[model samples]
Target: MLLTTVLIADFEKAGRATCQRLLQLEKKIKVVGEARCGLEAMTAAAKLKPRVLLLDPSGVEGEGVYLVSTILEKSPKTRIILLSERASDADILDALSQGALGYLAKPALASYLTKAVRAVAAGEAWVPRRMVGRLIDQLAPGQA
Candidate 1:
């Protein structure tokens, strides 16, 4: 079986653990690398070109937007999924504007996260249902 290479860009141990556990449970998503900060995340993404990037907004010096934009600029094919606790309107707006394909709250549920990654890898946006309305209403069309 060919597993998708998923690179995790979360500074916290718990965030990494969550990705590790989910990949372990599913066995189809392999974590190829990890980064503790936004700069490292960009570097790793550029070098590894993983299929998915799990980003922790809080870990990136609150510069998730910049990191997402940079990665998409350098590695346009990489799918970015923001992993965070606070998905405030501002955060969501920023992420969407910067081309983030999805956002997942922390303490991520395994099934949902897996589905999200697949959706993103398939070139589909996967925002939480609760935030879909907000994205449509507030975010610019064709932003991502």
Candidate 2:
């Protein structure tokens, strides 16, 4: 099986540890690098060019959404998955708007997180099921 490499950008020690532990259970996923800040994340992305980047932008230096765009600019092919405690609809929309392929609320189940990573690596978008309606509403207002 082809491995899906992942780079994690989370400042909290526990957050990174939790992600590492949960992702390790999946044989197809490999953790390539970890970054504690946005600059490190950008450098890692440019250097490693991992298939997926699991980022918690809240811990980064600049605005979360801006960081998303910056990272993509440097590593356009690297798929980003935003894992944040902020799950508000607006936050989810902003993340998606900024080019994140996946958005998962923090404390997400390992199954869901790994599934999201796999799906994003395969070039599919992953977001909370409830947000689908909101996204559709925004995309086609008053149509559906």
Candidate 3:
């Protein structure tokens, strides 16, 4: 199996460590870089060109949406996976609107996150099924 290179950008040491540990536990996933802030993430994303970027919004100093779009702009092929504790409809929708390919609510199970990373790396969206209908409703021309 081809390994999926993942760049984890979390502000706190513990957060980064936990994510790195979980990802390392997955044989097919390899963590290639770690960043503590938005600038570092952009730099790492540009240099490493990881297949997936796991970003924790709270860890990034500036606006999370900007980071998402900027990262996409810099690395067009990189699929961004947002990790956050905020599970509100608006938060998830906002991240998706800004070019994030996946959103895993904080406290997410390790198995689910691993699967999400693989799915997103393969060019698939990794949003929960429950959010699909609402997302469609919100994005549909007449509904929004």
Give per-candidate clash totals: 0, 0, 0
- List the global CA lDDT of all models: 0.82, 0.90, 0.87
Instruction: Looking at model 2, report the run of 10 residues with the lowest lDDT sum.
Output: 104-113
Which candidate comes out best when scored by lDDT? Answer: 2
Report the C-alpha lDDT of model 3 over 55-131, residue by residue, as the tens digit.
98886656676689999889989999988766677777888999999998768846588889989999999897888
By lDDT, the better pick of 1 and 2 is 2
Q: How are the candidates ranked when ordered by TM-score, highest leading?
A: 2, 3, 1
Q: Any runs in candidate 3 off by more than 4 Å, and if so which? A: 141-144
> Candidate 2, clashing residue pairs?
none
What does candidate 2's lDDT look like per residue over 1-144, in tens digits?
599999999989888898999999989999999999889999999999999999998986567767889899999999999988876788889889999998988877565889899999999999988888888988999865
- Candidate 2: where is the Cα deviation over 4 Å? none
How many pairs of residues collide in model 1?
0
Off by over 4 Å in 1: 138-144
| lDDT preference between candidates 1 and 3, better one | 3
Better of 2 and 3 by lDDT: 2
